[model samples]
Target: MSDQSLLRERWLPGVRELSFGGDYNPEQWPREVWAQDLDLMRRAGVNLVSIGIFSWGLLEPRPGEFDFGWLDEVIEGLHAAGIRVDLGTPTTVPPQWFWQQNPHVRPVMRDGTVLAPGSRGICCPSSPEYAEASLRITTQLAERYGKHPAVALWHVHNEYGAPVSECYCEVSAAAFRAWLQARYGTLDALNTAWGTTFWGQTYGDWSQVGAPAQSASMSNPAHRLDFARFSSDELLGCFTRERDVLHEMSPGVPVTTNFMATNCPSMDLWKWSREVDVVANDHYLTAADPRSQVGLALDADLTRSLADGRPWMLMEHSSSAVNWQPRNLAKRPGELARNSLSHLARGADAILFFQWRASRRGAEKFHSAMLPHAGENSRVFREVTELGATLWSLTDVLSSRVQAPVAILWDWESLWAQDLDWRPSVDLEPRRQVREYYERLWHDKVTVDFAHPTADLSRYAVVLAPASYLLTGEAAANLTAYVEAGGHLVVGPFSGVVDQDDAVHPGGWNGVLRDLLQVSVEEVLPLPENAGVTLTGGTRAGVWAEDLAPQDAETVLEYTDGPAAGRPAVTRRALGGGTATYVSTVLDHHALTAVLDPVLERAGVTIDRDLPWDLEIVSRHGADGSEYVFAINHAGAPVDLPVEGVDLLTGEPCTGSTKIPAGAVRVFRR
Candidate 1:
């Protein structure tokens, strides 16, 4: 076989169907139940399962002592039952023995409280002892099961920055200093970048630097931002360490670590995605939000974009209510299928959950799983099996890519910078801004992909920057070139306010984008709570407003009330071949939709105007020139979708109109 084919074979073995399964923890149950579990998995059309994620303590009960007999039996049973394995290194949870040996490796909080090892993901990323222990376990696992017939993929670790991301321990401090030296090369450059001269906190020696630990007052924003970067890199370094070992021992098998893409703000996925062979993500619905379905779509689209349009994996999601939320809400009837299909609609080749069977005890015992506590006869398990069968039938959609004409700028550094203290308003939430704009477009029936600010925008007809607090000079030049090349750009308020180092642009607000936008912000006006300002277009905005000065741009909507009355609340600048529109205040959803309608029309971006508000439509194109349209109805009543194809879910012919039941999903091959 060719090298590529050999690698594919090693990753997938003989599997030619879409992967369907969840994390299987047979160690939690007795040996008698293992056979029954395999039988049920076969009945559910499960072909792949992640094994040994939290098995560090179980795999090695004592230091250097191994217990692999049970694991070997489980793997043998899975292969005999025609199941593949996504073997995990189990490094996320270190054994108690190892923790006892290296107690100092425990992560320290900013207030100097050393975190105990009762929970998962409690180790410091920069600790050399933890690194050594993790690699030791990883090497043992890879050497044992690297060429195992059932092992298809290597799962390096669990969520990297969940319970703990940054550590204020002394080890982390020294590592942070080293990272700064490599990045800045000298203390002079570091001082200039951090702007430490203002508070008389400039460092003369590298030893004086710390991990932005607890201070008497607020720490420097630049220091905190770089520390966030360093922490993320530290976690990534831990992952690559194990991944390299796996690659060496299991030459052709693919390695990946699940990402909490939208959920975890610590890791920068735009950078992390480049390191993984297959990008996988774990997403859970926020029960508090009534429109969490919109958030789900947003997360799925972002995950797909992180994979660069390649088919990614839904590594973990709840079949019902999750245990961590303040008030866990159970999934309604058909909601499970709807959620899974929504992810599949957005280019997810594999549909998996956190676990196969619900745990009987532990902190996450209450967390929902494929097989709930109520067992296989329950609604959750029935829905899971039904979805599995549906996925099995829709194998043609595997490897298809979701195509989008619009792109949204997603920058983690900008988010981290904006999250710092003492911004214009604490209500200026970056994620909320992006989601509201995404929700508007979702309602407009527009499929969107996320792009880095500095990425090529020529492929997208319309590029939107809903929240870009930190816009670098290179990114600014890229945006200018994209606009000059005839691409429409829409920027939200409070953007271009800072550069990469969390420092304001040289001249004033809206730094590098001022020329391209043809406007400048004289000052930022943060309104009080519950207070709103009016615009000429009958739109009300609150929380944030800018004193905008239009140089050559035409005033689309001028403020009619409040501090900046009569100033341009919204402006449009005609550039070389296209136009750049800027919204100087946070507009309500209705107003945002109204504003984007004309922009969409001018850009020639088509929208499903006749589609129902609760119905979502997205298309994925196969390599063989086939198109699959997924229509998901989140409402409580049936809706008629106009499409010409055969429904893969029911295998029925729909000439033009298909009647989709309430809270149902339909995939049509067009």
Candidate 2:
């Protein structure tokens, strides 16, 4: 077997976990709707349900009143019906009374203007009134539901980044000043850190340092970046508050909150992952086009990597095309199967559909649900049942499973820092780079874990941090230690450029890796969008390219024929027992693969030679010396698989060749 295949066989008995749940609101329907939905779930093979997601209006109908009668009914009802319940905190959209009485409960924008309140998550984190009320409610929740046998896991707030940025009110101003005082000690220190000396924008006192929530100077990436940081920390602080309450109330119940897949720039997932007991993410991909599909799937993989490859629940999905899109398209008969399989193929633990029954009214009313208004005898229901039965046959054969070796460090902190940095390319978008890096590795069948910069790195032989945009003091030390201990490292352009406070270092901000990279630059070129820089003429390509002054390094790819031509777009240097590579431009898929081939070779990782274009292959090495191989054919025509293996989904044996049916996923074991 090929080296890649060898590694593949070890990632087996893959238990794919799914959330077979959707906004379950029996309160909106009759009791009979519950039975029909439950039966549909049984057919859909859904093992879990995330009920009471938006039940605030029903749970508490009055001021200073507590009522969970409906939620309690659903939990007991589902448990007796044989479904696991993921309990949502309902901490997101608080009851109207709570906010009305304490007007300071809501967040105010930077100009001291209050946010228009109509939607959920309008509360300000810095508001003492909001914080106190939110904590009180969360603690009350943990106190009430801690020992319920029906409760499986604690679901914190839903999509915690609602209302986007927060708190520019007087309370927020006071809090920001306090936080700054704690961070920079005084206004002089803050001025020095932000280099206020440059634009003469230095603060005279801590009170003058306010949040950038809709600041007067709009489009301030620096202030926006800092606001983004404060927002992330603030949101995380909210999460931590609830989790701590849960810790005190029910230590055994693992805590988690479903994350919106596309909501990255606002929420720091690295910080969220650390607080979540089991990282949960909602994947909503309704696009029919190929690029969008690829992008969405790459996002799924990146989300999986975010929490270090621990199996995460597929929190929310539409059974059919969601109405939220401009052009709503329903899932074809087997399309749900394709969607569920795609999630499993990437790294999803559970398969679930959002909104168990269709809403009778509201914006989501038109959205597809399991039991549509037509009831259980629908085409969607039949397909749901068929998939559910098939999943039941597997019974978590891939359960109690974990991802193997490869680690990818994804840091939102670095992204924020880079965005806030006063210099260099304004185009170094962290989210774009993250998706690009994850997709490249995933296409090659590399089992990767999304790790924090401060996470332990010794387990994986190779670590890829595409945009290590924000490198903290201790985190930089951790990276240095990882390299010194002989693990290969990869960093691209715009990396090691800033610290957590959105400030550059005196000695070239590559921090710990600067000495190891051996290359330093006082100024780097920033290419514009649509500006294509060709490297090596024959083999390499990248956008927004940069040049480097190589020191103790070999130039791998040079921009052979552009205005900024002959400048190095790629460079490599030997460091300790491993190697460090820097790519100056973001390569298109083919170009990216071409560049990564050499780097992967250096790291002793290889992909199959004759893999088909529309076919995706993945390899995972289990911790207990087991290997599993998954080959998925995403094309119309059947292809003859080239490797030898046994059929894993079933105990059936397979030979040297196998035909992977179109849109089919085949798992094999050696």
Candidate 3:
């Protein structure tokens, strides 16, 4: 299908996310249980099941291993029963034999020490031995099963980022230096890029410039930031090589791997998402903390947006609660359902529960899955079944769904560089400002596509780059072109401070943006914790404010008090057909709208007319150019979104206004 055609599908369309399925281990269960599951699927609408996430031990028990006996039979059984299957590569970790024998699959740290691997993801991307071994094994699997019609999709390396291992080993150190050499070229360039001259630290030779890190040694914030970038690139390299093989071999089947929320630091996601044809990710948050849960949702929307505003899938979610945190907490009754539905509302294509069947024994043995230890009679099972049925019934309506026109850019490097810098104040976090901007934007019924800051901005009418702390020359040029093309731009405070190398650019920080916005920073004001200011009739304040002087820009909002008081807090510059807007202070939800709404409207954009807080709406025109507007309610309370069209899911006649109940969605056609 064409990219535009794929962009128009729904995540759950006709299928229900009965969130009850667990790791389906038909291998462990008898044929009778398989029969029971078939009946169970019919009753609950369990149209899809994920097979073999943490089954490495079973799939590969010995060296040069090959054991798909049980997996093959399990898949055959599911297909025969008419249940779709999402297959796993089972490459989460090498078999003990491979790691033991090759010794090269292990990841290294910055201190140049090698790590022994029995745990998952110990493979080093740069290691020739690892690339050689994995190539043979993965290629073998792809060749065998790439054409299987029974396989809905292949899950590559389940949850690639947990247990946080950074390869600081000698191999990694060598790779890091080489990467640095490529990036900086000389010790003088490296010293300039790292600002090491400040501490009287200058490299004398290539060997003197270690892999900018302190993993097992004294952790340098700046070095850690560089290491994080390198690590993300390394993982991306691994994924790209494997995916190219799959794309060439299994072009018919859609492929995806799950992403953890943005909290993962080992890699930069903006670069990572480019490798996947389809973006897939897992969504979870601490239910006990309201603030935390909300943050996770925003992150998920960003994740879905990474595929250039295309809707994405929720590959894994908790069935009831989880077992891996410092404190294990079960989701409140109905909360899991609520979370799943919210994902659909935000443009998720599928809702997948992590494991189909709970583990009998393992680290995740006690984790919640659809069939509890007692089997299918459990309450979780019933909930799962009901949800599955709900999804199955509405598959056509939800598939091929599309979201809004506005997208947010979430750059991991920008975030890390912002955090690592020795800024004037400790109260401000770059991520905080970005998330707050999104919260308010969502509240306004704006659909956000999250992607690398350098992604094409032309796809969005109004692009938001909240706290783009690290701005590469390439990214700045792209944004410059975007504004010049008449796209509305809203940049948060503290943007354009550093270049791609994590060093301050002498061209007045924001570099090209300073020229585009027609503004230059006189200084960065470090405010006291409670210090704040109001601009444009209301209070607006946050961690720290950028003190800006307009070159040719028009001041929109000004700080209320202090030395920088009465100065401009928000500025706008006209470039080509579009406007470049910069905010000096972070605003609350109410204030953010006051600044952004006008700009979006001036661009002739419409915010989803005052819907409920949890309601998210999106519209799409199919390949035939048939128009569809999706109304999804994510809250427990029923809400009305006034519109005129037929309900695609229910076959109801055109209602003057659509009334969506709690956890329901309405796809309408004119």
Q: Which model scores highest in TM-score? A: 1
Q: Against the unseen true structure, what C-alpha lDDT does each candidate score? A: 0.90, 0.68, 0.70
Looking at model 3, which ten-residue stretch has the lowest summed lDDT? 11-20
lDDT string for model 2 (10-42, tens) is 221222434455556677778777777676666
Please give the ranking of all candidate structures by lDDT, highest first, separated by commas: 1, 3, 2
RMSD of 2: 5.5
> Distance from true position, residue 33, model 1, in Å?
0.8
Full candidate order by TM-score, most accurate first: 1, 2, 3
Better of 2 and 3 by lDDT: 3
Instruction: Flag the better candidate by lDDT, 1 or 2.
Output: 1
lDDT of 1 by residue, 1-670 (tens): 7544344322254556789999999999989989989999998889899999999998889988889989999999999999999999999999999888999899998888899998998899988888888888899999999999899888988999988999998899999999999999989999999999988999989999988878888899999999999999999999999988888888778889999989999999999998888889999999999998899999999999998887788999999999998999999999899899999999888999989999999999999999899999998899999988999999988878899999999999999999988887988788999998999889888999999999988999999999999999999999999999999999999999898898899766897789999999999999998889998868888888899888999988888999999899989998888899999889897778777888999999997768788998889998798999999999989998888989887888889787989888888998
